[model samples]
Structures are given as structure tokens and as C-alpha cells.
Target: MADALTGVSRALREAPPDRVVEAADRAIRSVLGASGTAVFVADYRINGLWPVVDSRQPEVADQAGQSMVQRCFSSQQPVRDGDAGGRCRLYLPLTVWGERLGVLMVELPQEPSEEVAARAVDVAGEVAMALRAADQETDRYRRARRRERLSMAAELQWELLPGRSLSHDAFHLAGQLEPAYTVGGDHFDWSLDDDRLTVTVLNGDSIGLAAALLTAVTVNAMRNARRSGGGLVEQAELASDTVYYQHRGHRHVATVLLELDCVTGRVRAVDAGSPHLMRLRGGSVTRVALDQQLPLGMFAETRYDLQEFDLDPGDRLFVVSDGVWGADPSGRETYGQRAMARSMRATRLQPPTEAVGTVMRELQAFHADADLRDDAVVVCLDWHGSGDREGG
Candidate 1:
């Protein structure tokens, strides 16, 4: 065990940026005495798992939905399965603090002794942490995980995001953007400060480079407002004002900004031109009807209204862009609010991360072969509170 870690440390210290994942794969496989190894990262869009490193193949299909990988990731436990021919496969999930980084698979030449199995588990954990740290230091893993090259617009939107999911003592939130490589100006941001959680879900009307810049400006303004101690209305106002003056006198941004007192289950939000917010509680979904407001940059002096509400325990709030609700560009068909409601209710029990994926899949299936003419996104926020506690 010590030797395994020593080798990993040496690789970590000397491995070049391009070979980090390859080195990790080699170390894990060498230490396990395995014929080969593969590492598959879970994609944020839930389109499929992506192979970041595999000794046998240059690229591999998304195998996360496969029985073994699913079992390991969902159960947060290692799985050992042997086939009828006595060939053994070991699937170990690499995760830290409940965030799944990827899965490590090893093809054992022979049944491992108890000691070897224990060592494999240790190596899995170490690799998970190493990937997380390496991801920050190098783009090797990022490049490997992506299925295709992103357009400039999609690249900007991707750069503006804060991963796909987050959780805290009082809440769990997850979000996904569609048309991964071609995604335009659809993005989400959240910050957990003490007991307060600030969230922003944004969509831009323009596409390509224009949509990307509008999203960037809108997100930065919202972040500035939040960090400056602005309330929900103020946050929306700042973003709107910035876009109004900055977008060549056009209202190019639509958004919903939220400030939640997680401890108290209180939420305050400003909804502009984005799709109406949907709420799921007790297995029922309802569309929130707030006063209509202009998209950011639409009106110079527009004062955004704040819709204040208290959530019950086990309540989920969902936000989606117009692209999702109106993916069928032809006015003849509608994804419709009721259909959206049904989708949310059906998947309310899943973790926010899985819930959004299912919803997106359903929506895409409904739209069939139609392309998303606009940027599409979904943000799911789950609050599990007593609804009676007061924030200190």
C-alpha cells in the first residue's frame, strides 16, 4: 500500500500536464495487477458518461448508464462482478464529499486477495482527489472528458458556470445546459454564503458570439450585486441596468435571481422574461405566476418586483429557459406549461442532479429531431427544511 501511494506521489510530482490522467490510469492499473483500466467522467448534461482515460481504447462510449458503473456511482460503493468464464471486473467510484468525480474500472488477471481489494479501494479514493486537484491545475482531463469541440459561444457559457451541482446543510441544487458543444447563452450561478444562498439563472436572446458576451456581462453584474450585499431586487436591477446600457440599447438578457434564507426556508426572487419558475411540493407541481416584467436592458427605469415565498420541507424549485419550453420553433407546437409541470412532478423524488437530467431527456424527446434554436437550460433547487426554523 505504501509503495502504491509512493509511486502515485512521484507521478503527481513529475507527470506533465498532458499525461496526468494517463499516468493516474497507469498507476492504478499497475498497482492492481490488472490487464487494463478506464476512467469515465459523468457529464453535466447527463447526455452520457465520457471516457477520460482508457488503456485499451483511445475513446470510449458513455458507460455510466451501464449496470456496473451505475451501481458504483449511485450506491457510493465498490462493485465486484465475475463472469461465467472466471473473468473479474472491479468498478470503483471516485468521489469526494458526495461529488462523484469519475469511475475507475480494473480488469483483474485473477481474483484479488483481501489485501489487494483494500488497496484498490484506497487507490480509488486517492485518484478521485487527485483528479479533482488536477482538474484545477490542468486542462488535460477537461479536454479528454468533452465529446466534441465547443463553439466560441458555448465555450464562454461553459466558462461562466459553477459546475452542475452543489449541496449544503439546508439545500441541494443542480443544473444542466443542453446542446453541449453548441450551447449558446444559457448559464446558471450560485453562491452559498453562510446560511444564505444566492442563485441566478440566465438566458440570452442572441446566439454565437453575441449571446456569449451578453451572458458574461449579465452574470458578472449579478455576482457584483450579490457580493455588494444587494437584495434580490437590487441584484436584478444591477444586471438589467448594465445590459440596457451595454447591449447597444437592446434588452438581450432574461433572468431570475434568487436570494434564499436557507435556514428559514424563505426565498425572494425577481423573474424577468425567462420561463416561469416551477415549484414541486408533496408530489405536485405548480407554475409560479409573477407579474410580467421586461427582460434585462428592455427598459432603462424598470423596477423589478420581488416575489417572496416560503417553502415547505422537501420543496423543489425549477427554472428553465424559453428554449426548453419552446424548443419547437414553429408556433404550431408547444412544450406547454402543463407538460413542464408533469415532467417536474414525475421526477421530484430524484436528487436534483438526476432530476434535471430526466427532465431534459423528456423535453428533448418531446421536441424530437427539432434543433434548439435558442440556448436551453434547467436549474433545480431542492430545499429540505423544517419550514419552522428561524435564521440566526
Candidate 2:
């Protein structure tokens, strides 16, 4: 098992960017004595899985196979089934540090023993790590994951994201954006350092490429400050000043910056403009009120205030942009007034990763399945609290 794993890792390291997946497939088949191997990656929308090779698109006709693959991906578990001619097919989820990349399907000569199955799971983990590393070197995996062409603005926004989800012993965090292919301004980002976690959400006050650019600048400014050992106040101030100098009061971005002490469930925040916060504790959901400051870039040298809050273990917090809560489809009722809360309640049992997506789906349904008029961002955080902490 060790030799096989080493061979696979060596192959991945030696392969060129575009050939990484092919190299992995060949190595797995040779090392594991498998008849066939394929890597399937979840599409951009997370609605379908597409083979990394030998297929131009996801197989829409193969409902059974698709379901099996989806199940493995969603549950982060290995699934086994009988293949043709007494062979056994194994679907192993390709996940790394809580991120669901896709699945690795292997067709073995026969059903494997428990040890072999365990080895396959380890191999899948290695492959996922390779894929994550390859992302910087090639766009092959990214292209395969996209079912449709992305608008320039959407491309920029996607590139600016820290990631779709992150997990830790203290918290589970996930976020999503609506109008995936053409998303404009709304964006979210986060960083974790030891027991401290920082999260930011931005709602650019513009549309199309302009909004994308605004968001990009603001995000980078905040990131720069954060990376320089700055706290919420510094991040907010630096971002505000940068945006203000760029647009000179003509453009602005509504944002919420949060810093959490993982051990104590203490949170400090800076709320600038439209992104709103809500908390779910026990069974009830209520808005988290913060001092609203001027949107970034609204004026030169705008001073921002920091607000403090605490979360009990098992508490879930959501930060949504105005595009979500203020969504008024065809002049009807706004989504935040009721539908959003109902959606949150419905998905309370789900992990943050799944809950974020479910909430976005509900938002779409509230829009009557119409394309969202504005870009929307939703971020969910579940605080599990730290084990070493004395009190909740």
C-alpha cells in the first residue's frame, strides 16, 4: 500500500499541469491493479459531476451512476457497487481539509478487502491534494468544472474568493454567490490563524464589470491590512481609504468585517453599509444588530466603529448582502421578511457547506426561478466552540 501510494504521488509530481489527471488515472490503475480509473469533478454550480477525461460533458442520461457519484461526493464516503463481469466499482470522495473536490472511481478485478478499501481512501486524499496544488499551475481542472462560459465579471469575482468553504475544530464556515455565471459585485472571504478566524463580506454598489472591480479592490485592501497584523479596525479603515481614493465618493462598497476568537466564541465586527447579519440559536433566528457605518469609498477617511458579540456553542450565524435580503422580485415582497428565515429553519440540521447552498436555492425559488437581478452573497458560520474553553 505504501509503495502504491508513493508511485501515485511521484506520478502526480512529474506530470505537467494539463496531464495531472491523466497521470493520476494511469498510476492508480497500475499500482492498485485496477481495470479502470476515472476522476470526476463537481461542476461550477455543484449541480453535476463531469469526468476529467474521455467525456466532453457530464452524462445526463446515466441517472443511476450520477446519483451514486453524487452520493459519494455529498456524504464524503466511499461507495461500492458491483460492476460488469463480477468486478467491483469503488467511488471514493476526493476531499481535502473539508473541501469536496469530486470523486475517484476505480473498477477493480473483484471486490476488495477492508484494508484495500482503506488504502483507496488514502489514495483519493492524495489525489485531492494534488488537484488543489495543480490549480495554480493549470486551468484544466477549472475548465472541466465549468459547464458554461463565465462572464468576465463573474470570472473576476470567482478568482478573488478565498474559497467556497473552510472547516476547523472550532467552526464550520461556508459561503456562496448567486447568478454564478454572471455574478457581479457581491463577494465573501475568510482567513484563519491559529484560534482566530476573520471573515469579510462585501456588496459592491454597482453592476457588471464595474462592481467586480470595486469588490476586487476593496477585498485586496482589506486583505493587505489583515496580512500586515491589522485587526478589524485597520482592515476596515485601509479598505475604506483605498476605495475612497479610487472612486472619490462616486462608488462605494457595503461590507461587514468579523474577527472571531475560536476559543471563546467572542466576535468583533465592523459593519459598513448593506451586508446584514443574523444569528440562529436554539430554534429561533434573529437579526444581529451592529452600528451601521458609511459604505467604503462613500467619503474620504470615514471612521468605522467596532461592535462586539458572543456566540454560544451550536450557534449559527449568517451574513448576507443586500441583494439577498432586499431582493424584491417584480415588486413583490422582499425575501428577507420571511422566506429567508424559513429557508434557514429548514436547513438548520445541514452542515454549513450544504446549508449555504440550500439557502441560495431557496432565494432563487423566492425569485420565482428568475435570474437574480443583482449579485447576492451568503455566508454561514457554525461555532462549535473550543474543547479547552471553560465556559460557553
Candidate 2, clashing residue pairs?
Answer: none
lDDT of 1: 0.76
For candidate 1, write residues 115-214 as lDDT tens digits.
Answer: 9888888877777777877777778777766777888888888878877777676788888888778888888898888789888888787788888888
The local distance difference test score of each candidate is 0.76, 0.87
- lDDT tens digits by residue: candidate 2, 1-392: 89889988999889887887778778877877777787899876677888886542223236777788988888778999785778888899987777778998887899898888888888898899899889888998898899899999999999998878887878889898878899999999999997899999998877999999999999999999999999998999999999889888999888999999999899999999769998988889899999899989889988888999999999999999988999999797899999899888887888888888888999899888999998889999999988734443
Candidate topping TM-score: 2
- Worst lDDT run of 10 residues, candidate 1, spans 56-65
Say which candidate scores most in lDDT.
Answer: 2
